[model samples]
Structures are given as C-alpha cells and as structure tokens.
Target: MRRPFEQLPRSLSPLPGEDLHGFVLRLAHRLDLTPIVLLRHTGLIDPHRHSAPARRMFMLEKDELAAFCTTTGMSPQDAQALTFKPHVDSYPPVATALLGLRGLSPAPRGVFPVWLLTTSTRYCPSCLAGDGSAIQQRHGGPWKVVWRLAATFACPEHRSFLHTTCPACGLPAQRIRGRSRSLMVEPHTDPLHPSRCRNVTDPEQGPCGARLDSAHLTDNDNPSDDLLNLQHRLLRARPYGTSSALDSLAGHNRMTDLFVLAALIRATWPLTADLAPSPSLARALDHDIGRPGPAPSLRISATAQKRWDSDVFSARGTAALLAISARILNLPLPELRLELRRVIAAMPPLDDAAWGQTWLNLRRDSSPLFRHEVLQLLDQRFPRPLPTHVALPGFLLIRRRSYSPKAIPQFLPEEWAEIITAPLGHTSGRSPGKTAIRRGLAAHLIQAVTGMSLDDAGTYLGIPPAWMAAWGRFRPLEERLHGCRADLSVLFQRLTDHVADQRAVDYAARRKRFANWTLPESDLQRIVENYPGRRRLLARGSQRGARMRVGFSALVWSQLTGSEWRLAPDLQPLPVEGVAMVDAGVIHQLQGRNPDHQPFYTYLHDLLPDYASTVLEGEDHQ
Candidate 1:
C-alpha cells in the first residue's frame, strides 16, 4: 500500500502553461535533487519499478496528480492543467481515445502516434533564458506544453524556428532513450543545471552539462513571416478566428483537415511543387524530391520511409509542406477539384497504384468537405464503370435535399426514359434491349448512389441479382455506355435541369400522402357504369369482386403516385391473385400493347396536374 505524501519544505511555484515533465525538472533543480528522487518522494512513480513508466509522463492519472498536489502544496486544478487533457479535443494527436484507450492511462508499449512529439520537443533558446524574475533566474524558464506538438514549428514570441536538437551535443533535448527509467535525461545526476544538456556522451564520460539558454547556442536562421503566422494560427486555443475558410469547421475538424492536407502534400512531393508559397520552400521541396532515398545506399526501409513521409521534426520541411497544404485547403470547391486533378496528372505513370492508395487513405482520413472534393474529382476522372464500393456523385445520389432512392421508382418513368434514350439516336439496331437497359439503369443508379453491393441494391429493388449479373455477362453495360460519354454527359445535364425546373410533380411526396389511401366506392361505382362490358367482371358483394376492387384500386394508386404497380399498398399480401387481376386490367386498358403502356400512362399523366391542384386547393379551404 502507498503512504500519503507530506508537504515539501521547499518547492517552486508551477509556471503557467508548463508541461508536467518540465515542472518535475524545475522542482528537482530548485531542491538540488534528481528528477527520479523527486518523483519517488511524491509517490508519482513506483520506487521499485525497473523500467521507465510505459506511458506518457505528461498524462497523469487522477491519483498520481492528487499525490503530487498533496506533496507540493499546489492546487488540483493547477496540477491538472499541466497535462494535455484540456487540449485533447482541439488537438487530435494527443487524444488517447484515438488509440482506443480511456482516461489518462498510457498507451500500450509506449507506442504513441508519430504525429505527437512524445519522445522529444523543439525549444526556443530565448524562452528558456527566463523573464528576469528571481525564481525564473534561478531555475531558468518554463518549458512550454505547445512545443511538444508536431504542428508547432516556430516560436511566435522569438520569431524563429524552434531548435530540434541540443547545439552542444547534437542530441534531441530531454529525450528519454530505451535504457532510461525516467522522463529526465541522466535521472540520477545531481548538482546539474535544469537548462544544461544532461544527455550522456559516454558511460565513462558522464553527462554533457552544456547550458541550453546561452545566447551563443541559439540557431542563427530566421523564419519567414508566413511561417510564423501559420505557427501562431495553429497554436491558438481557438483556431476558428484564424481564417474564414477554417471558421466553418469545428476545432477538431479544422486540425484534422490541415493534417490530412499535409499528408497528401507530402505523399505527392514535386507534383505539388508549384503550390509552394516561396522560392526557398520550392527549392527545399526540390531537394527532397531529387533524393528520394535518405541514406547514401539509395535504399530505405518502410518504417524509415514512413517517418520521412511524416517528417514534422524538421522545421523547414514541415513549414514548406504545411504552408502549401493551407493554401490548397483555402481554395473553393471547383478550384480544389481542379488542383487535385492537376497534381494527379503530374504523377509518374508508374505510380498509378500509389495514387490509388493515397486516394483510399484520403477516403478514410479526410474531413467531410475535403472528402466531397475528392469524390467530385473521382466522378469526373472515372465517370462510368465505377467499382461497386465507390459512392456515386452527390448530384446523382441526392436532389432537393432528399435521398434519390426514395424518389426513384423501381421502373423508369416514361418521361425519364424519353430523356435518357433520346441520346442513343438509332444505333443501327446494335443498341442493347431498351427494356433491359431502362431497368438496368434504374438498378445501377440505386446501387451506385446508395453505395450498396450489386446484389443488395438488386434485392432492394425486387430484381434478382443473378438476372442483372447474367445480362451484364452477355453484354457489359459499361462498354456500351463508354462509347457515348459525350452524349451521355449532355443528356445527364438535361435531366438535371429538367428535374430542377419541373414543379408539377413530386412523386415521393404523393407516395407518402397516399400510402394508405384508396379510391372512394362512389367514384368506383360511377366508373364501373361506363365499362358495361367489364361490369360483371368487377361485380360487388363477392370474394372475387373484393380482390378485383383491390387490384383496380392499386392500379389507380400506382398511376397517381408514379410507382410500379407491384409497390402499391396491400399488394404484397395477395401477390398471385391481386397481381393477376392488375395485369389483366392493364392489358385491357393497353389493348394488346403488351410491353408498351404509353397510351394509358399518357392519359393519367395529362390528368394528374389539374387533379393535384384541385385537391390541394380544396384542402386549403377546409
């Protein structure tokens, strides 16, 4: 069992926005003790453990933080603010939920995401030199929490890029190697300055205790204003104020978009060369592009290559990539698609498969707006013969803010068929079967728009998947459609325009309003008197008469709603008897036009507009 911690006789006040690891170092330095001793004394780390705590040291558990507060006389809120917990929502990389963990528990195997700078941090020398306060002068200065984020590259206050490694020893500052058992470098070393380099040069030579805050140690290179601005925007707690394009996105989504865009920019390097904001950036990009491999041997392992691909550690490389990504993200939808196409066109022919992989990754990782743009580009590039897995274009899948599947009937309506078939233009009798093509087109549209499997969409539409599959085997629909791309494009545009302008009919609305409605018996009786020849066939007061009435009612319902006769209410229960009667009635009306019901369809279509208007006007009076 653990013992309660007692208040420390001497301790430094916690600095604002300082990380937990940095606080531990500063407190240890103030008391002339090593970080490991301080941690053990506070009961934050187990004194008996042989290995470094296998979780991120910055993320503390509730009890651990309570113990630290109890021992140091600090408030719980102040101690809690030291961890990345508050920023998790705005910063995705620090979100442990992404790693499938809960609360402040460390990740298994210490395997954090590469996007987080858990093992090392970038630092500005001037910030580490303190603010001339007595306490700061004694302990150097606060090591900030934001410097641990890979997205943060430059120090806005100092107007320079953060140094990645110690200038004296050439090792990443405060890095905890595999052999170490604590967060601090040289954990047991005493009498060492908190701002000095403590990384061991040799087992015999001890630690390289070089001052990190000295003026001579700072890097001479100055950062561009644009880079500094980008860094400032990224570091702001609320990023919505940065730009209009970013204001529309939530904090998490905005950061996600930026990260995804950066990934894409890096994945296709020189192809995105023209997107760089400055010549220096373009030259840096060219240098990386020229030498594809990092080592002199011209070979790179997959892990190393992945690291290089997501290289946020290098200040110049990350700045160049992120600057280009931000510019691209700020583009409007049409230009965004065009820019993606331009980059894709510049890709090497041999890397077609690579581009495909990148697209798949984008599909998984991109924000909704970015995903929509990619989908639009995909629709234009591969307009026809799309894979079953791919989603159809948004225009094809939706209209008037409603799902297309609900609006489309099982069979193509006569007016829609005319619009689609008008473009084929007498293909010398070589055109596919008109009935098969129309039905196939309906099924294909449903499948593509809903992103369902071929079999699933067919089943949903009451068409057998095997039948459509067999038809495609005999004469692939794609081959025929591919030849008429130009005509089809124009035809599609015409259909879009027609649908937009047509206000006389809303089949989906009619279907919903009349889902359970049937023609009144008074109207049916009056209509029966006109058809004396079929009067006995539709006689009332018998089982046969009841089925006949239901069948005819279904016919009227189908006509009014523009749905397939098979989809009318109460038809599913009497599939055999009801359907037979409905079929006979249709044939009687068509008069030997077995497959063409245009005459009857035209009569109903011509009558519907006035009937709908009368019904609505009467309802308004009521």
Candidate 2:
C-alpha cells in the first residue's frame, strides 16, 4: 500500500479555464519540484509500476482525484473545472466516445481522423507570457483547454493563427508521443520554467529548454478580419458562455455540422477553390492539400492522403479550409443544395461504379440534413427508375411513421389506384398491362413508404422470393407506366398524401387474430350440402380433402380481410397443382360464372362478417 499524501506547504490556485496538464506543470513549478515527484506524493502514480501512465490520467478517476485534491487542498469542483468533461456537450471532438478513445489505456498511435486532435495543441505566444497577475508572474499563465480542439484554429485575442510548432525544436508544443504517457516532455526535470520548450532533442543531452513566450509573430501569421470573426463566433458557442450562440445558427448539432463540412471541404480541395476567401488563404490551402487531377484518389497515394487528413486538424493551413467551410454552412438550405450540386457537377466524368462509391462515402459521414440534400442532388443527376428486385437505398425511403407495411396489399388498392391515375394524365390508349404494373407499383410503394427492402416487402405481400428475382424480365413493361420523372414523382406524392390523410386500419391486429383461424366444420359442410359431388371433394380424412379445406379457409380469409389468399394459414404445405386447382375453384365460385355455385358463394359472403366480428371481439378483450 502507498503512503497517504500530506497537504503541500506551497500550492498555486488553478487559473480560470486552465487545462489539467497545464495546472500540474504550474503547481510543480510553484513548489520547485518535478511533476513526477508531485504525482508520486499524491499517489497518482506507483513508482514500482514500470509501465508508462495511460492517457486517461488527464481525466482522473474518483480515487485518483480525491488523492490529488487532498494533497493540494483544492476543492473537487475547482479541480474538475480544469478538465474537458464540462465542455463535452458543446464541443464534439473532445467527446472520447466519438473518437473511439473512451476507456483506452495509452491512446493508440496513428493518424486519427480530422475530427479529434489528441496528441498536441496550438498556442498563442502572447497568452503564454502571463496575465501580469502576482500568481501568473511567479508561474506562467494558463494553457487553455479550448486550444486542443481541431475546430479552434485562430486566437481571437491576438488576431492570428496559433503557432503550429516550436521555433527551436520545430515540433508541436506539449506533444505526447506514442510510447510516452507524461504530459510534459521532461517530467523529472526540476526548476524548468512552465513556458519553456521541454521537447527532448537528444537522449544524452537534456530538453531544448527554449523560451516559448519569447517567440514573435510575422506579418503572414496574422489572418484577415473575416477569418477572425469566424473564430469569434465559434468561441462564443463554446460551453464557457451562459448561452451558446451557435444553437441559433444550426441548432444543437452546430459543432458537429461544422466539423463535417470542414472535412468535406478538405477532401474536395481545389475543386472548391473558387470558394476560398482570399489569394493568400488559397495558396495556404494548396500547400496543405495538393492540387489533384479529376479524381483525388487517382492522383494521390494512400500515404499522402492520410497525411492530408491529419493536416486538416493541424495548425498548418487549417484556417483557409475552415473559412470556406463556414461560408458553405451558413448558406440557406436551398442555396446550399444548389452549391453542392455545382461542385459535384464540376467533377470529371467517371464510371457509375466510381460515382456510386463516392456517394456511399458521403452518406456514411454526413449529418441527417446534409445526407438528405446530397441524396436529392443525386436523384436529380441520375433519374433511373426505381428497381423492383433490389432494396431501395435508405435516403430514398419515406419517414418510418408515414406508413406501415401491414396496411399495403399485394395488388394496389382500388382507392389508391384512383389517386395515382389522376396525376398520370392520359395513357395514349396504350393498356401498358395495368395489372402487372399495378402489382409492381404495389411492391414499390411498400418499400418506399415503410422503409422495408424490396424482398421483405414482396414476402409480406405474398410474392415469392423466386418470383421477385425474375422480375427483371418485366422491366420494359414497368418503364412504360413510369412515364417521365415528373409524372412518377407526382404519382408517388399523391399516393403518399392519401395514405397520410386516411385513418390506418389495425392490420397487425387482423393478422394476429387470423394467424391460426379456420372456418368451422359445420359451416363448411352446410355450403357443400347443395351438391353431393362437391361435398365429397371436401370430405374429411382424404388427402385431396385436406388441401381443399385449406383452400376453403383461404377463400374465407380473403373475404374477411382484403389481404392476398396465398398467405392464408396452413396453405403453404399444399402442392403447386393443388394450390392452382383451389385458386381456380375459388375464382369460379366468387365470379358466379357457374349458376349452380351461386348459392354457395352467397352463403360464404354472409357467414364471413359474423366470424370476423367474433375475432375482433377477442382482440378487443386482449
């Protein structure tokens, strides 16, 4: 067991908005001891444990926090303020869950995605030179927690881009390498100033020890006023403020939206070159993101592409990319959609497969509103009719609450047919095989409204998977009814409108009620009593009778519920020939083509409603 920590004789109060790592550095400096020594005394690190500390140390656990607070005599709330946990709701990048870094020991080594900046932070030289207060004069000023975010590019107070790398070492300030876990480069070194560069230049020699606060800015380091304003807007949106200004701009997800837009701007570089604010900013972006040919993947190697992605978060040339991204994000939805369309149209001609892959990637990374707009642009660019055999992409589906699959039938309902035809105008005297087209239309509607896949919708409607696979042969006929894109859109909208306006039936209840239902034996016998031959055909115990019983049950099921007869309970086991015979018999009786069978049809029509009411009664009780 480790010894308990005693209150320190001298400890500095944490500065406002200071980060946990920076506070540790300043506290160690105030007591004239090394950071590692202070951590050991506070029981934060075990000397016997040779392994390096984990990155999670920055976000201390309960017991670890208690020990640190006890030794420093700082309140828990004040210590917690030095960490990033409070800002997670307003700032997205620091949310460890989003970065896939939550609960990780030492964070993995690699080029992380542009959304997170974990390894290092950019700094404003003037801020590090102390605030002229007594405590800051003894130990350097606070290293702000906000500086670690990739979205924070410019220093609003200084009116310039934050410095990317140290002047002497040419490495990022306060960088934590893959194998190293300590926040400071030289954690064991005593008497080093908090604002000096501690990066290890050589193993044998000590750190670079260059004074960071002494670095000066050049003319080019200053950015335009517009870029500064953008930075200010972002700062106002941070959690430190009483109210987020960005909430009014893009709602709750404004930071995430901005990050996604910046990523897209970086990916599609000079293709969006015209959107750049100034000539100097354009050159900076060009240096960071090289000018590629028509397709970015074709010109850039995989390694170089990874580096470019990393640079989007780095201080090197990020201002230009973010400036362009902010402008695009500020546009109204209509103008934003048009601008995106123009950018996509400017790309060099590529095959359909390549374009599809690009769209897939965009859909994967985009926000919901952004994804919807991109899909609309795609629909305009490629007006191919919806395919019947394959699943529709998610973007094409209606909202889930709009319709239910159980409410749709195998054939288009008569009421829906009337609504759809109104928008189609005259058919030019061409039949176009309305029955087959109607069935196809029914399948399409199930998928479009309920968000089911083509196969799932077909199965639900009593269409076999094998039959759907062979639907390609009828594509030509389906195309005739589709007419032009405008007609198709109008027809679909009308159908959707009708569905939304009407009260939905309890089809799920009907399905549950009829799942194991069969017509009573007494009712079946009474209908067949008129003709002895027909009665014998449906007699009990015969193989043919068993099939005929299922068929009769299916016929009655179709009468009670308007669903397809083929989906009737206990009917799937019958052979194809038996099913065909049963179907033909049912059709003959219902059509009243045979005068002799007219009485039997009348009896069935009268009996079904009574049986349906009984089933509904049971459902009500349940």
Score every model by TM-score: 0.56, 0.55
Global lDDT of model 1: 0.58
TM-score of 2: 0.55
lDDT of 2 at 438: 54
Best by TM-score: 1
- lDDT measured at residue 465 in model 2 versus the true structure, 0 to 100: 65
For model 2, the stretches where C-alpha displacement exceeds 4 angstroms are 49-54, 96-113, 178-182, 237-252, 290-316, 346-367, 378-622
Residues 494-589 of candidate 1 have per-residue lDDT tens digits of 554554454545555666766776655655455455453434334566665555455556666666666555566746543543357555565244
Q: Give me candidate 1's TM-score against the actual structure.
A: 0.56
Candidate 1 lDDT at 524 equals 49
Cα distance off (Å), candidate 2, residue 21? 1.3
Q: Total clashing residue pairs per candidate?
A: 0, 0
Q: Residue-wise lDDT of candidate 2 within 1-622, one digit each (tens)?
A: 7677788887878887787777878888888888788767765667664322534323556776788799888898887677655554455434322222111121223223334444566788878888888888878887877776666778888787888678999877876554444444567776678888877768688777888877888887787888788787675552112354434223224555555555456555687778887787788777756533211112122333332223343353677777776777678878888777875565433232222223322332334577566556656665563222322222122322367766765656555765655444534222335544555556766766554556666666766665566553224343444523333333455677677666776554565566677766665666566443344335666665555455567766764455556557656654544457656576556545557785646555455566566656765799
RMSD of model 2 against the true structure? 11.0
> What are the runs in model 1 whose C-alpha is more than 4 Å off?
50-54, 96-111, 179-182, 215-220, 237-249, 282-304, 307-309, 346-365, 378-622
